[model samples]
Target chain A: TQTVSQSDAHVTVFEGDSVELRCNYSYGGSIYLSWYIQHHGRGLQFLLKYYSGNPVVQGVNGFEAEFSKSDSSFHLRKASVHWSDSAVYFCAVRRNNYAQGLTFGLGTRVSVFP
Target chain B: GGIITQTPKFLIGQEGQKLTLKCQQNFNHDTMYWYRQDSGKGLRLIYYSITENDLQKGDLSEGYDASREKKSSFSLTVTSAQKNEMAVFLCASSTGLGVYEQYFGPGTRLTVL
Candidate 1:
């Protein structure tokens, strides 16, 4: 089984400030890594995913993530955060196979202030 | 872009009551999933169906039942409601054809009294 870990439970930042959310996983075989955002009372919105090739993947709203094989990490980053970016971000992992649902982390709650 | 709709935005049930939640998707995806979310936590998969009448249990499938009546509709039933249980149920769908990305519904909030 695959497991995901989002070390930070909450992160607070000001508008225009940079923010980074840490994510790590433990799996022996190939896997798919992705990020999702959920606003208050809303469903999860897909951000981006990484399967192979380039280590850096860009997502919606100026958000991006870097995958590190040596570190077993897929950390999300944003150059400048907006107040609207304040939400719960989740890191998920899925095995590279069929008929499998994703295993999610505990989630990191980002709070951006003006 | 297609959308996923879940019926009854909010559900309140008595302890031990049998409650059902319904979901529909216009994406015509071949796979559907049901997940539960608790406060301050991430989602846990309850069940999934790759096709009509096909059910697969996930890590947290106990006390829940699921059905896929057609290509676009999937439903979940709470066999027995637990008192003070409050969580959100989310529905999602995917192509089931090698693409792993999924689309989600707004979700149904459930509260057991």
Candidate 2:
């Protein structure tokens, strides 16, 4: 079985400041890691995914994440956040095997203050 | 280029009533999934379908039933609504499964009174 964990429940940052949301996972075989963002009263939207080769993957809205195999972590980052960036971010992971579903983290709620 | 649509954005039902949520995806994906999102808890899979007319139960399939009548449409039914039970039901689809990227619909919020 695989599991995903988002350590921070809530994060606050001022507008124009950078932010990083931490995610960790526990798995044995090959895995795929990805991120999703959800706004209030909305469904989740895909951010980015890391399968193989590249350690850092870029997502929509200038968001990027780095995959650290040694650390078993995939952390999401944004250089500059606007007020619209305030949302709940989730980290998910799944095995490469066929038909296996994704395991999502509890999610990190981000609040941007202007 | 494709989108997922879930009907009845907000649903209010009485306890012990049977409620159904519908989902339609134009993505032409081979896999469809239903998930429940509760307050403070992340999304949990309720059911999934690999192809038309196929169904697979997930971790929280106990009080729920799912059906896939066609390739593009999937429906979920709550066998019995629990009082004060409120959560969001999300519908998603993927080209295949696992590593494939899944697209989600806006979701249907269910409130049981």
Q: Please, what are the lDDT tens digits per residue for candidate 2 over residues B8-46? A: 999999999999999999988989999999989999999
TM-score of each: 0.97, 0.97
Q: In model 1, what lDDT does residue B36 have? A: 97
The local distance difference test score of each candidate is: 0.92, 0.93
Say which candidate scores most in DockQ. 2
lDDT of 1 by residue, A27-62 (tens): 766768899999999889999999899999999999
Candidate 2 Cα outliers beyond 4 Å, as residue runs: A95-97
DockQ, every prediction: 0.65, 0.76
Candidate 1, B40-95: lDDT as tens digits: 77899999999999999987899999999899999999999999999999999988
**What global local distance difference test value does model 2 have?**
0.93
Of candidate 1 chain A, the 10-residue stretch with the lowest lDDT total is: A94-103
